[model samples]
Target: MTIRRTVKRVIDGDTFEVARKIQGTNRIRIAGLNAPDSNQKGYSEAKNRLRRLISSKQVTIVPVGRSYNRLVA
Candidate 1:
């Protein structure tokens, strides 16, 4: 199912958190994105780009699966 929620936080380039009021989960992983890890080069740039794109914005989430505790979309 697809849902819309405001972006609460950007965890990294490919992962983020939505509003807590939504059901199921708030954490979400962007599917198919292989962004730089925390210790790697360009990590901050990638994360910041994502933050600029989605932070505090309402986004559509189409969940495909679950990884760790985050919903993959």
Candidate 2:
């Protein structure tokens, strides 16, 4: 299913939070993106880039699966 919502926060390079009416806040993981982890180099850069690209913007999500608490899309 395709879901459209405003991005509420950037969790990292490949994950972000979106507002949901019933769920409160939902975390989304960009499918196929292998961004660096917090301990790795370029982690901040990747996260900043992602944040700049989608911060406060309404984005379309097509969830493919779930990883922990995040919806992979």
For residues 1-73, write the lDDT of model 2, one tens digit per residue. Answer: 8999999999999999999967789999999999999999999999999999999999999989999888999
- How close is every model to the real structure, measured as TM-score? 0.92, 0.95
Model 1, span 1-73: residue lDDT tens = 9989999899999999998673644899999998999999999999999999999999999999999999999
Q: Which number leads on TM-score?
A: 2
Clashing pairs in 1: none
lDDT of candidate 2 at residue 54, scale 0 to 100? 100
In TM-score terms, candidate 2 sits at 0.95
What are the lDDT scores of the predictions, listed in order? 0.92, 0.96
Instruction: Give the TM-score comparing model 1 with the true structure, all chains together.
Output: 0.92
